[model samples]
Target: MPEQGMVIRGGAVVTAHEIKEADIWISDGKIVRIAKDTLPKATGTTVFEEVDASGMYLLPGFIAMPTPSLYKRKEGQTYIEVMREWVRSGCTSFVDVLQLEPWMSRPQLEYQQTRHFNSPLDYAWHLGMEAAQLEGRTVARYRELGFSSFHVTIRSPEEISSIQWETLWQLSASKQTIVHLHIQNDASVKQEQRDLIRQLWLDATKYWKVRTVIADSSAAFASREFDPFLHIFRLPAETTDRAVRYMYQRFYDSCPVASPLQEVRIDCRRRWCPPEMLLCLLVRLASTNIAKAIGLYPQKGSLTPGADADIVFLKKENWLTKYDLSTILNFSETHLPTSVMSNGKWMYRNAQFHLSIGMGRRIFDTKPNVYVI
Candidate 1:
């Protein structure tokens, strides 16, 4: 019998496939029950905190993996300030994408320590790789130091052949470490270069048996043609209605056949895409698919029983009613989460953070699981 528990009642729970009215009971930092009917009276064995979630949508908290093309830190800004901005946007998890170099060791450690001591959100690190870093014992050293994933940036065909592909393949295969490829804008435009990129993905997935991802830094790649593979798109810390419009436009341009309503929605009185499509793009692909690509699928991306209780509660009326594109987009982009729960604890409520600074943990995928191809 758990000593502490909470029941969130009467909210429409949004799962990956469907949204249904359900009551969620959380205990010990995990979801314990999702009941369609009202729960029976509790025996005196458990102390329960009850929350009314009527007229709200209870969804998994957003997870962001940001990769800045330039590594310049904003003047006078601290990592905690950056994380607080993300938290205000309903993001619960972050993965710091870094460039690989011996000189970066100190700064990376300092960043990790700062996040550990000042931020109130979970975080991880993904290191960008260089050919020299692929030499003897370097990859092993990263694994020992708790680096979560490796990133590879390809600018030209010569660079691809220059890398010791076989070595990276074997290391990733043996350790199940995720390898992310950033095919730069110029390289992605050429036919021959695109072919090479596809071939590399085949080798990584088929021959090496390693989980791989196509990391899109600028979001412009969403409007380009590329081989079918797992993709992770970067999102700004504090998003806005204009940004949402730009993102939807990119997706519409890239996959017009897939989204047949692009023309009608774009030309509608709203002058932007439907809010549902934006939600699917930003929440489903950005948060859930990225989680799956990084091998943190069911644990971080889902709200099923037994998963971590990282949740965001949003007012249904803000998004479901008839409104202009700017109005609807603001619900998700500009408006803060009405309430947020991390690890079964109330971290944010009534548009304010409730958790203390440094309360969040550093999360990583220590045990890599099999990914469906």
Candidate 2:
């Protein structure tokens, strides 16, 4: 039997379908029961820890799908510290994208080694693919090693040749692997050159016929709809009101996936979105929608019984006001979670971290949906 159990009482539990007041019971690192107010007594003597969640919104923890290499530890900062920052912001799961290196393998052991095992979070790696890595049985090898996705950054049309597109299509059709594409403006390249690359993407999508994600984009392309292809905008760590307006507009109009990494800046300070719309976007759309887009739904994105206990607790008092669109968009940017639980372990509670070194685990899709070409 597991050593600990917990009961969170009197909070509004938010699930994908709806939100309702309930008490949650968790044991052995999984949610065991969910009831209106309290649970029935157990047969054995088990002292479960109790947390009063009255007047709070209990939500599934945020899943951050950050651009590879966006986070680099500042001078003298440790890995645990960096991860703690994520927990502080309510993220319990994240995707770690790494640049392709000659010695890299499907699982990318070197990158995995950097994860703090004692941290109270989970992560998965997506290896960035360049030209050389796309050749031969590379995609097959990645599949064999249990990778369900690959990352590719396109800066020029030359990068998406017929052969490259064919390789990507074959992999997606046969192996169900997703391709995360980052389309960005290259300062070194001329405008016409960048335009040509954008044109290639618009044209290649019709042929690829695979699940592709526009991982990051500029304002010009943020609102453009790419049907059958999901768009996940990467918000600048410090951005303006105009950028926030464009991002939120794109989110509602285009139905793109959102991540916690797209933080906004006001008065020289970085913060999360306004409380009024934060949960709807960050938890519902950003976490749940993105998980489904990547084919890791229900398992990673939900808070139902038997789902992984990756949850975030938010104070109700901080959010109860109605705000206009600009107030909703331009309000402070940091949404600090009151408490965070990942895989049934308390990662952060009452603004304090309860993590050790090397506690975080790797997450992967065990039964990914196969996409037919």
Candidate 3:
């Protein structure tokens, strides 16, 4: 009854505890069936339409919360390229971490529209708090355009007191939408600043649901601002290979912050987080099962029958499947995700979906294998 092809038999099926072997069948853009130790043969199945995913890690797609970072280079990535990576890297959904700046209103809508076509991944956005939306029609316009959440940056330059902070909390709580803030970086502010931040957090919860998410932690590491329990030793810049091995225990396959930070994100900005650190964040997220606490539904973080089959199958940079995503996000090194799926479409298959990647393949697909590579 569905439109897409089926995927059968992956060796490593992601379970609650570990990866196990199983047969998975997808239809209607979702996982229609999954079982172990057996296969159901059928007639009239489309030829070459099913993938025998043996030995492959059939992973649930990743969900990325945005970090006020935008790609600065215009020609660097086209819409298709961005989406391709989202899927190829096994990311089915992403939230744009935005700074509520001047263009936050108009561009955000344009961005959502453009990105929807660019990637097969589901995209959500969090608005960075600035008073600017109050003066303009930005809020009314963008809110109607589907900007459902607002992330207020608490680290303000002004002298913010506890009572005033409580007022800000009340204001956001009354809005009744998702309210989250950035709290991770402390090197830039004094202890008094940290205390004010804490006060605001407490009061914010009094009125709002108290949602929080940090986009990355490497910046916090540089600032020595990671929470004590969740802190990781800074790898030496000089010896990455040696350092990576040593830091293994300090890291999980995924490294989430202490449970407290799950309720509140400390760092709100997405500046200078290279690929390696991104991988660290994902590993932490996967390890702690933090998404379960914050997610909207059950069976998330999965690609199982009856789960929201938002799946992403990516081309691993190190060609290491069935392993954690540490290799890509740890060294700040850039690698292509190469494929992406949202609910279940091939957003990016062989390579990047951006214009650059698409144009090259279109012009060169006719070439022989010898010259193509």
Full candidate order by lDDT, most accurate first:
2, 1, 3
Native-to-model Cα distance after best TM-score fit, residue 87 in candidate 2, in Å = 0.9
Q: What tens-digit string does per-residue lDDT give for candidate 2 at 102-201?
A: 7765456555546434444677667677644664377777777667777776666787773466776677777877766665546876778766765566
**132, model 2: CA deviation in Å?**
4.4
Query: In TM-score terms, which candidate is top?
Result: 2
Which pairs of residues collide in candidate 1? Answer: none
Model 1: per-residue Cα lDDT over 1-373, one tens digit each: 6488888998988764457789998877889889877665364666668899999888887776554621244432465566666666667776666677566675575564453445577666677875445542677677767765777766665665555566666667677676666666574468677657656654445454555564432332333433233333333223333334554655533221111011112222554555556544445444554566566666776788888898888787775563454423333354456888888887778877677677777776643335331
Instruction: Go through the candidates in order and give the C-alpha RMSD of each one to the true structure.
Output: 6.3, 5.0, 11.8
Q: Higher lDDT: candidate 1 or 2?
A: 2
Model 2, poorest ten-residue lDDT window?
Answer: 323-332
Candidate 2 displacement at residue 57 in angstroms: 0.7
Q: Pick the candidate with the highest lDDT.
A: 2
- The lDDT for every candidate, in the order shown, is 0.60, 0.62, 0.41
The order of the candidates by TM-score, greatest first, is 2, 1, 3
Residue 297 lDDT in model 2? 66
Give the better candidate number (1 or 2) by TM-score: 2
Give stretches of model 1 more than 4 Å off.
40-45, 69-78, 104-115, 183-207, 216-282, 327-331, 366-369
